[model samples]
Target: MSIDSIDAAPPATAQTEQAVREQALVEEVIRSFASGGSDRDREVMNSLVRHLHAFIRDIRLTEDEWSKAIGFLTRAGHITTDTRQEFVLLSDVLGASMQTIAVNNEAVGDATEATVFGPFFVENAPQIDIGGDIAGGAAGEPCWVEGTVRDTDGNPLPGARIEVWEADEDGFYDVQCSDGRTAARAHLFADKDGRYSFWGLTPTPYPIPYDGPVGQMLEHYGRSPIRASHLHFMVSAPQKRTLVTHIFVDGCKYLDRDSVFGVKESLIKEFAAQPAGTPTPDGRDLGGREWTRARFDIVLPPAGPSTATATKTS
Candidate 1:
């Protein structure tokens, strides 16, 4: 063969050159967002581009896979409604929601740990006073919950707003009911001493809304969609950080395998079971039915910028 013809052959470095070209494309996309936007927006987009490209490259993603992902996201968007948030469920099942919470809520002093804010929180929940019933006729074994809202320094945060919600024993939130029945959720305020009490329901394990795109993803990954038994709480005071968390049932079987990856050991509390005819804390009649009670004292961290402080265990 002629020397010129031999020298024109492709070199063994062709694959490496191809990778460089691919990475150049990634950089080009990132630079498109680098200008003309706010600093934070640019930062987020650049990071997202870099990480997303790395993921695709790492998996050597195929065109079929990319198409399937696009379809999955489109279906998620289609299924979302005012009452149902499929995208939040997607983030929850992937542990993204909990990771974001961990980044924003630093462990300061004895402050309560935060967890995933599930897809069921609603605005303008009915207001109840301390020692009032919040179940709102939800069906379940009655549970009496009492707690004191205090700062990390142990100062009572009286008048703190406490919002609580949970699934009924049948494993459905009020918003999920077909008849638009409002139950199993309410809001109340702390008393003068930062103490609050309300009658709710003993939480039960429930699968997140399945039969959706998120559910199909979980099924494909061989993951369960059932979350641990718990009651959701969002507590806030004037000068304190708003805390979104859950007090899990200590003995729940799903605690270790919570679908949303939201179970924190410090957030688990024992729900003391009471027999029939037991004296209630507020002297309410249960009519010869068994009940349970739980106490969850919440300590709020101060409102401030996000920190990376190590979490303190209770």
Candidate 2:
């Protein structure tokens, strides 16, 4: 029989009657959110209810599973702190952060691709010179990174601001410092020629804070928590889009399976090995140990009238 005929004869049995009642209950719950405070709030709440209800129905989810999910969220919140953000970590592991970035920051021309703005970024990094060091007493092999910023039309952007931060050789950011001292982070400005360089540590593969509830979720699915070796950059120039991105260490073991799925082929850069005793760009002697060099160029798109100052830097 056709769906129209099938629906016409539906609520005769007790089971059918109960099913109809349940369907009406779900609809009423969804509709109740229509009067939320603002249009955006109403839209968000209404859509959330619809999708959530549909999911609950599709899975025929048990009350036990629902309670477990709530408990997981509670634990995530409990573990969150000024130093740690379990929620962002959870979103990153689930690919939702990357997906949201892809949706909102669609690539324009040769503009640099953005990854997660990760929860680690701190405003007001100490400013340094164009070729100064950001290691700040952190322990690791020195790496030289130089890059240029330009517009989509290839015009150089002088005085662009660049902020950089990364983990030490052991894979912990400055904010995660056990001694409560900042390290491996700084800000600098581009030169008149649109070039900026700095001394940083060659990034090493590190595991995310896997001692939390998010980690438990990953463990439940048998997923590794290792992120690829990389350096983070937040570049901004006047009249250009602010670009938040990273350059992955070429040949890093986790490149193929970054825990947060942040790796992009174009963002991978080779950290060239330099022999010991080589002279550095800023005229410093390399001394005994071999050093590494990586260069990443950023291209930003016009920010239009909405974007404000890009005046801060390294």
Candidate 3:
């Protein structure tokens, strides 16, 4: 019964083989996927195997726990639909999507930082004129938003295209409009001088939809589902870079506690109440009560042409 005989046992190559068998089974399932999928499918599946195996090894996972995890993922997949993406919602809540976006699109200089688009971005938004209000007839306080697109050198980058959209006063976006299409959702490109402006009613803070499994997951984790009041922008330039960010409304209670953790101090802007005679460029009367206005200048990095070749010096 010597201690040396117990701790000096030989390595278990058989146990390592069993672990490989389990990992191989997972890869077999993934390899059966057919067309229309990207090449990253295999890459992701392989990486997933390594990480998942590592997790199991770290926890010494039991069969019961593994079965429970499988059931949870199955339910998450079943809860997905055309309008609702439970998977994307899961990614957002876990900060995976934000991390992925940041890794792929590293912002240089003063360019805006991109965050998760969430699961509510809908394609084919209605194109509206300059200075048009996308807020529709929603009853909320008026807010004027203006901004210019410039390069890192503080010069205007003309002809930049800026796509804008936001939730209504009720925190319901146009895609979320169960009835007819709402007027508060529109896309407007920048003016010739790289300036883009628009008017809209202030968006209200609202809890994300809690009728689904994602909601249940949030509640189980003791988390709230409220996002701060802000406007979404996707700005792109011809030769420069593109940006996806939010112009956060000032004094929002949820600014510090955005459900997705998307609030940035530099992104926040003042939303002051303006007078009735605010000379609206589009002839829309934002009069009567006071309105909130914010102006932000976006800066994009230089183009990719100069990325190659070193400069010759004496």
Top candidate when judged by lDDT against the true structure = 1
Higher TM-score: candidate 1 or 3? Answer: 1
List the pairs of residues colliding in candidate 2: 128-314, 187-313, 187-314, 188-313, 188-314
Model 2 lDDT per residue over 140-253, tens place: 999999989899999989999999999999988888866778789999999998999999999999998999898998899999999999898889887777877889999998
Model 1, residue 309: what's the lDDT?
30
- Per-residue C-alpha lDDT of model 1 across residues 130-208, encoded as one tens digit per residue: 8888888889999999989999999999899999999999998998888988898899999889999999999999999
Question: Between prediction 1 and prediction 2, which has the larger TM-score?
Answer: 1
Assess each prediction's global lDDT (C-alpha) against the native: 0.86, 0.82, 0.69
Q: Model 1 clash pairs?
A: none
Worst 10 residues of 3 by lDDT: 305-314
Better of 1 and 2 by lDDT: 1
Clashes of each: 0, 5, 4
Across residues 177-293, which tens digit of lDDT does each residue of candidate 3 receive?
677675666777777787888877776787776767767888999998888887777777777756767778789999988777777888888877667777654556655666777
Q: Residue 99 in candidate 1 has what lDDT?
A: 84
Model 3, global lDDT: 0.69
> Which residues of candidate 2, in runs, are more than 4 Å off?
1-19, 304-314
Determine which window of 10 residues in candidate 1 has minimal summed lDDT: 2-11
